[model samples]
Target chain A: EIADAAEALLGAGGVKVGGALRGRHVLVTSGPTHEPIDPVRYIANRSSGKQGHAIAAAAAAAGARVTLVSGPVNLPDPAGIAVHHVETARDMLAAVEAALPADAAVFAAAVADWRVAAEAGQKLKKDGNALAPLALTENPDILAGIARRAEGRPRLVVGFAAETQNVVAHAQAKLARKGCDWIVANDVSRDGGHQSGIPGGVMGADSNAVHLVSAAGVEHWPTASKAEIAQRLVARIAVALGPQESQS
Target chain B: EIADAAEALLGAGGVKVGGALRGRHVLVTSGPTHEPIDPVRYIANRSSGKQGHAIAAAAAAAGARVTLVSGPVNLPDPAGIAVHHVETARDMLAAVEAALPADAAVFAAAVADWRVAAEAGQKLKKDGNALAPLALTENPDILAGIARRAEGRPRLVVGFAAETQNVVAHAQAKLARKGCDWIVANDVSRDGGHQSGIPGGVMGADSNAVHLVSAAGVEHWPTASKAEIAQRLVARIAVALGPQESQS
Candidate 1:
């Protein structure tokens, strides 16, 4: 319906009063994907799904019709969002593909870059000291695939770069490599290099320090609650996408 | 307070009514522990903490004072219980150590068997073709540690055996190796080898099929919700612990 295409285009980059994201469809992904080693055991990242869930909630609060694709997490489904639960990276890709054709998409999931090339139907035995070696294979680059879509691509796509050392540098490279319009980069190291007393990085932590990277340049933000970061990010997205048209 | 010590010792080892666990103290661990590779990335298992949380809830419902030491999960704290959140297996071990002195303890967490010997203080770069190799070291065996404690160990310690093949045999071996009183063994393989039409044996599923392997023998249970399994387990524990003496 190209909902709010005009108002959004005209409004300056900021939170608009008239339900900035009203009538717009937004897709978001959160949590960590499990790449199976065997049916019972899987390799995974340490993502608690908090930040992505918060972002989905913020987008919904901003009046967007949100579709949240989540990996295995203990969290309850967020109110006012269509949630698709999945386990593996392939499942997440399929779910994302199915939920597409939206105004915007957010890729916040920590999908494993690789999966066991061939999973064992049965559990591998501990047979002696040397465990069975797992063969690796690359998973689909979901962000790049979506960004480089020839048709039906989202108007705006945001990807996250959770790096420790060269946070901004890696995020910049990821923006180019992944072909996404915006990158939300954050340092997730726990060496306490940031301002003392502020818990900057690490998963499941309530707070974050993020940078909004785009062709316009990098906008570093102060350490804040994950909920607050989500709100501000949603605000930026609303400003870029503009306000929604009247509801049917 | 030798609560329920007599009846528990004499009961036929099953669920009994009348708040059999009243005034009893029980401790439990749930979820998968993360082993850091670098500051930002980690190796982890695909555990949703559902079973562990359900067990904690069930114990509380049976009138026991429960202390749940959990790894990173998004679940709301269970009512009427104390919760200690942790991240890594080491952190989990520490938390469990600090939460000792209970009538019983349940080790339901998927503790990592190995951790990167040394964590990268800074973000490890994805340089060139090969990423840095992850040198792993053995993690502390929380269940075995508590089970074989020199003093003040819980009287009825329980451990979980998430195995794929020879589930009962492996569980029996673990019971002996870990020196725990009981072992809740379950097949986590996904080969669909179980009775047809039933979804069984895997992580992240809402339901479970488990075997309670104790010194007495193995008790095979029907497939049931995680909550139901927790309830039945607590019942057995109560019966094992017997009836409590009158409170002060």
Candidate 2:
């Protein structure tokens, strides 16, 4: 890590300086969107936003101009990045679209796939009876929307797959379905693949093990801190973007 | 507050030294219970656990042996208190039941009234279609369950009501229905009635306005910091329980 930092310091001299991603614009999304059921209740995905925030921080450290659209999380905003805090999937999509035309975009948020079709204007009363089943509507597919952009599409679009079973296979399917350039997949089950040995598993754990699935093939990353995984991902992004000539 | 602390210090010389609740056991429940829809998704009430945690801290400061049963919250456990962390309302109820026969019990948790009837073991897939309405079953009413206890009932049982409208009315009804001694009720709406003027309102805010509802009637408390409200509540509890002569 020290060597990489030192090399990045000495390697670039022009408009691009410091890290390989210098002079590039990278957009990232983090945390879990909260879909409100009423004034005091909501539905949400379980996410700490650790990995996504780390990625944004790493990108910023790499000297890239970073725009981070985050959901409600306990984490502080990463330094030197444009951050937009949002609550629901619809709001997140709007924010991401507004910060567009980036070199690369990483969709790391555990956005709800569906939200309450009819959110209550007031708190629903419990009258000693069973509540009617809550109807749900599909939330916009943010990854697919950005990846399938007809105009001003980012050069690289990345998505994340948090699965309990068939991690790689599911990730591959998601990558193809979303039309994203790559998919970062991880097992989030309490047991089985990529176990962090932590009580809550990778969802909120500091460490993670992931598989990078792309058109070329699959690459299994060793268990490491979420920060380390983020740094590695940023480094890979820099490589994929290639030389300064191609960057222009 | 400083004068009160000093008075506590100067008063009492035996087992009741420092504060009125000395040598007493107080049980508190805080935060919002999460009811899982699947391995990854869940429904929850919006709560910061600040008020409940503050009450626990205040009780401990009053020299009480505090047993706090907390749901998922970002706050640290109060010093010199027995804290049991739980996720779902059922687990919270079990933990609370285990730490019973207390002098007082405070149900400050914004427990879910209902939970998904069928919790999926695996992540539910998004198969390019609208998802069916989620069936929900009623969760155990921890406050009512404890308040209605025939044996080992606490001398003082307090419940909290987070309402969007008809704050005092709802609280009064809740006190009678739950059979709890008192109800600390607050308005949690975005606008009007006890508005904290904060972005997220009273749920996660530092300050709050509450009404203490009991069979004795309602006592309106002005908007104050949650800590202040806690201290005031604890003081009332101490007074209600009366001098240590009733200790044995």
**Top DockQ hit:** 2
DockQ category of candidate 2: medium
Distance (Å) between predicted and true CA of B131, model 1? 3.8
How would you encode candidate 2's per-residue C-alpha lDDT over B1-248 as one tens digit per residue? 43354336334431233467887899999999999988789999999999999999988988889999999999999998999999999999999999998999999999999999988888889874328789999999999999999999999999999888898999988998999999999988778444555333798888898998988888887788898788778877877776655556
Poorest 10 consecutive residues by lDDT, candidate 1 chain A: A1-10
**What lDDT does candidate 2 reach at residue B74?**
98
True contacts kept of each: 0.36, 0.87
Model 1 regions more than 4 Å off: A1-26, A46-67, A73-82, A98-104, A124-136, A149-155, A191-209, A221-248, B1-25, B53-66, B101-103, B129-133, B150-153, B191-207, B222-228, B238-248
Interface RMSD of 2: 1.8
Candidate 2 is scored at a TM of 0.91
Question: Would you list the C-alpha lDDT of every candidate in the order shown?
Answer: 0.79, 0.86
DockQ of 1: 0.32
Query: Which 10 consecutive residues of model 2 chain B have the lowest summed lDDT?
Result: B9-18
